[model samples]
Target: MSADSTHAVEKDDAVFHLPGHPLPALVTLDSTDGSGVDLFMLSLRRPVLLNLFSMPVRDGRVDLPSVAQHECAQQLRSVNAELDALKQQMPELAVLGLSLHAPECLRRVREDLQLRFELLSDQQRAWTDKLELPLQSQDDGSQALRRCTMLLVEGQVSRLDFPLRQPSEVGRRAIELLRRETGTM
Candidate 1:
C-alpha cells in the first residue's frame, strides 16, 4: 500500500474506539425516497445526526415494543420535532434514522408515527456488520440493535452514544456540538 493508504489505515485503527473516526463512505443505505445513497457522502456537506434503532418485533410472541424501546422511539421523535426549529439556524444540519428492518417495514412505521426524518433500512445488516454495533438481547433471547446515536461532521464521527440512556439528552448534545462547531449559538 502507498504511504498515504498506510497512514489512513493506521488512523482508522487508532480511532476504532474514539469519537472522531471516519465512517464508511459507500454504505448504500436505502432511504424513504426509494433511491439509495451513500451515508458518508450524504453527510460530507455538513453535520448528520444518525439515530440507530429497531422496530418492535411483531412475531406471535409480542405485539408491542417493550417499555424501554417505546420510550426511546418517542424520544427520537421528539428530537426530530426539535430539529425543525434548528433548521433556520443550521441549514446544513440533517437527521437520519436507521433500523434493522427492510424499507417497507420502516416505511409503515415512519408513516404511522409521522416521523420527520428519513429512515434507512439495513435489511442485510451490512452497516451494522461493518460498524460492529452490538445487538441487544431480547427477553426471548433474540438480538437486535439497541438504541444508539452518532454525530457525523464532514464524514467523520464526532460523537457516538451506545446503549443510549437518555434520548432527549442526545438531541441537546448534538445541537450543542453543532452550535459550537458552526458558531451559531
Candidate 2:
C-alpha cells in the first residue's frame, strides 16, 4: 500500500520459533466441518501449507448510485461461489481466511459465503501487529491483512511463500508446492 508492498513487510533480525510466532498462536479458524481448528497447534509432522486472505465484497467498489436491481439471494450465491472455489482449491493445505472486519462481519461471512475453512479474526489486529505483518487499515481501524503464505515442515517453518499476495494465486501456488513436496511433481 506504500508504493510497493515489498517495502512494507518487516524483516526479522533472526528466526522466530515455529510456536513463538505471534500469528501462529493467534492462528485459529473454523473448517467446513463446523469445528474450530488451531493451525499452530496442529501436528504438522509432514509438510504443511497455509494460505491467508482478506475477504472481498461483491459490490466490490461499486461507489455509484444503487444498482438498478439486486437481491439477497443473488448476493449470497455470489459469495458462496467464491468461497466454494477457494475451499476446493485450498484443501490438503491448511487454508485460512483472515478478516479485518468486525466480529459481526464474520457471522455474516459464515452465513452468506457458506464458508468451509475456518476463518481467523484479525478484528483487533493484535496478532498482525505482534507479527509485524504488512497490512493496510480500513477507516474503522481494521486491517486488510496483506496476503502471505507460510510453509512448515516437520513442525518448523522451512520456507515461507511470504509473497503469495492474493487468495487465488496463493491457493494455486500452495497446491503446487504441496504436490512438489509429496513428489507428485
- Highest TM-score: which candidate? 1
Q: How does candidate 2 score on lDDT?
A: 0.45
lDDT of candidates 1 onward, in order? 0.65, 0.45
Over 111-178, each residue of candidate 2 has an lDDT whose tens digit, in order, gives 55565544555556555555565565544444565555555554444444454434335545554545
Model 2 regions lying over 4 Å from their true place: 1-37, 43-48, 56-93, 139-142, 153-155, 165-167
Clashes of 1: 0
Q: Report the number of clashing residue pairs per model.
A: 0, 1
lDDT of candidate 1 over 40-96, digit per residue (tens): 887788778787776556452333335235754676676677786656557877888
